[model samples]
Target: MIGAGSTVIFHFDIKLSDGSAAESTRVHNKPAKLQMGDGSLSPAFEAELSGMQAGDKKTFTLEPQDAYGMPNPDNIYYVDRSKFSLDAPAQVGMIIGFAMPDGSELPGLVREVVGDSVTIDFNHPLAGQTLTFNVEIVQVIN
Candidate 1:
């Protein structure tokens, strides 16, 4: 059975509320591996796979909060148009990389470009959407 400390290998297909495919491990023939109780997955997701054996296949749906959670209003920001260069104009629906203080880059989606002001959203693109997970357990090492 799958439980804490168990290393599980599984293939998954993620679908959006509209029944469109979002992601799938089976596409590349690469299953995902994760140790139970790890922070890699949300508590709700872990609970859904608490008890299972190899070859078990299940489909479950999760609300927005249980998945990526709702989008935070504070994640939206407005920057001066001058901050963007002519080479990469700030257009709506564009994903731009913003530098962080830790020397890493974060992706923010351009929402709007008003007069001398550009709006960007840093929330996950899938936030606030319901998701369906089709999972097949390939192996479970407890």
Candidate 2:
């Protein structure tokens, strides 16, 4: 059984509320490892893993707040249109990387284009949506 400090390796398939597959670890043949009760996994997510052993499979759904939380309106920012490169003109649904003062890059999705301005959303794409997870526990490192 998985304990609070246990490390778990598993294969997961995540789907949106519409039943559309969002991501799957099986494609890369790489299993994901998570340390329980370390804040690495959400509380609800960890609860689902508790009492599970290797070779076990589980399917569960999470609400927006439980998964990625509701989208934050404050994460939206407007940038000058001139900032976009001609090689890759800004377009709706495009994810652009913006640099931070700390020398790190953050991804923002283009939401809309207006006169001399482009609205970008920095929220995680999966935010504000319900998600379903199908997980197969492969190993318990603990």
Question: What digit string (tens of lDDT, one per residue) describes model 2 on residues 81-105?
Answer: 9998899889999999888999999
What lDDT score is found at residue 52 in candidate 2? Answer: 98
lDDT of 1: 0.94
Per-prediction TM-score: 0.87, 0.92
C-alpha root-mean-square deviation, candidate 2: 1.4
TM-score for predicted model 2 compared with the true structure:
0.92
Compose the digit string of candidate 1's lDDT tens values, residues 17-135: 99999999999999999999888888999999989899999999999999888999999999999999999889999999999999999999999999999999999998998999999
The best candidate in terms of lDDT = 1
Among residues 3 or more apart in sequence or in different chains, the pairs in candidate 1 whose N, CA or C atoms overlap within 3 Å are none
Cα displacement (angstroms), candidate 1, residue 10, comes to 2.2
